[model samples]
Target: MKDWDYGELFEAINESYEEFLANGRGEKFAVARAFNEYANMGKIEDIITGVAIGEILASHDKVFIGYIEGITGWLSEVGKKDLKNELSDGEIENLLGRIATVIRDLRNKPIDSNPVA
Candidate 1:
């Protein structure tokens, strides 16, 4: 499996989010396309893609909530069997919620930039 670049992953998501905001909601969500691209890259890529999606959900507006079912359906269409199974079991939302919780908690914590000498 190729080593996925986190920068690229986040960049794709950010660009997609910007597009979603610029265009009306009627515009197809580019983030799902990004997820589709990454999900096919490898077995583990879906997990990373899920994390990216969760991060977006964590920091961004609630607009994405309305698209969860669509995203879940898209993933079911293209994701691996294990992912499909998880989606079928209706656990993707739970997983995303957990990931978002972790992201939200991390974001809430302050970073200490200065190191003790």
Candidate 2:
């Protein structure tokens, strides 16, 4: 993965929605484009920030997904299940850092094998 600037990622996500809202295209088209951008993140590369942005979007009701579930689902998946609530920039960075570290550690863990006794 490329070195990520989570701060930049957060700004980009906010900018994207704001831009979409102001776009000359109709709201439907703008939303479609936004969603396309979300889907394209995986196509271009499995950038953690991209996925993170998507999850952030998912936490909001403005996108037609659902009411705000916060990021609990994501946190739980990464094994930090207890974390919940609105967050400041620094808190978000710390959470993302922990998630990234856990992901890295899991990726690097050796596969285990057992012989039949």
RMSD of each: 13.2, 14.8
Which residue runs does candidate 1 get wrong by more than 4 Å? 1-3, 26-34, 60-117
TM-score, predicted candidate 1 vs. hidden true structure: 0.42
Candidate 2 residue-wise lDDT, 29-103, digit = tens: 544455455444431122333344444444333432221122233433542233233345565567667556534
Give Cα distance to truth, residue 39, candidate 2, Å.
4.1
Model 2: lDDT of residue 57: 42
Residue pairs with colliding backbones in model 2 are none
Candidate lDDT values, in order:
0.49, 0.43
Instruction: Give the winner by TM-score.
Output: 1
lDDT (Cα, 0-100) at 17 in candidate 2: 57
